[model samples]
Target: MEESKPMLRLKRTLTKGNLWLYILSELKRGRVYAYGLSKKIEKEFGWSHGLITSYVVLYKLENEGLISSEFEGRRKYYKITKKGSEELRKAKRYLQQLLNKL
Candidate 1:
């Protein structure tokens, strides 16, 4: 059995308006499997949910056309789409504005 880990999902670190931004940023690094993504999130962001939660976010992104996935061997790898990159740009702009305001 796998060991249990204490981590919160990406959503927990971001506002509802910015959840996808962080996810897309990670994807920008390269395609990643769900479990791999989750672990990276936990290490980098210091919070990540379980495997099921990670998959749920992946499915949502896939449905929204912000990301795509493919099966490679026994794992499914996910990558950001053009739309996702655009959204990431928007998020960066918004963050810049917010920082400037403060």
Candidate 2:
């Protein structure tokens, strides 16, 4: 069954809002390419926001110094930096606080 437009929009809104946190959490596990990040998120969280969005977020994260990337042969693998880990911790705390309030 197909989801309605409103539900689809809701999903995209929620996923896009928190993609950075998801990426950082996954990268904490190990380095992965942009595509791998998308797959992992889908497998774990059941959210597939699209591959291009992943690349766009990755580029932004790299620029912000939350993550670092390296080219291994031809593939670019990304790993979360210490700053990213710290940010993830903060984000988790904020989320927990929000949940507790509700």
Candidate 3:
């Protein structure tokens, strides 16, 4: 059966928009490598969309300058940038406003 519009939107929001938020939130703690990110999200958030999806989001975030990465030997670790913190603050405010309205 086909999904409803709201359900589709929820799926998209959770998978994409919120994935970005979650990644940024986790990075707030400290730097984490790609493989470790998947595990950390699953443990902290109780859900993960797999490594491929996380990597895609990581690449987009890096490209947008929301996060930066450094090589630790063969592994790459990611940390949030100043711009990323500002964006996260904006998102928090937006979410608070939306919640208040609800």
- Count of clashes, each model: 2, 0, 0
Model 2, span 2-85: residue lDDT tens: 999999897777677779889999999999998889999989988777898899889999999999999998899999999999
lDDT of 1 by residue, 1-102 (tens): 643343334344463334456578889999998878877776877765667766677788899999999999998899999998887888899979988999
Instruction: Estimate the TM-score of every prediction.
Output: 0.78, 0.87, 0.85
Off by over 4 Å in 1: 1-19
Q: Identify the candidate with maximal TM-score.
A: 2
TM-score leaderboard ranking: 2, 3, 1
Residue 54 of model 3: what lDDT?
90
lDDT of 2 at 93: 98
Cα deviation in Å at residue 82, candidate 3?
0.2
On TM-score, who's better, 1 or 2? 2
Q: In model 3, which regions exceed 4 Å deviation?
A: 1-12, 15-17
Q: In candidate 3, what are the lDDT values of residues 29-91, reduced to their tens digit?
A: 999998898888889977767789899999999999999999999999999999999999999
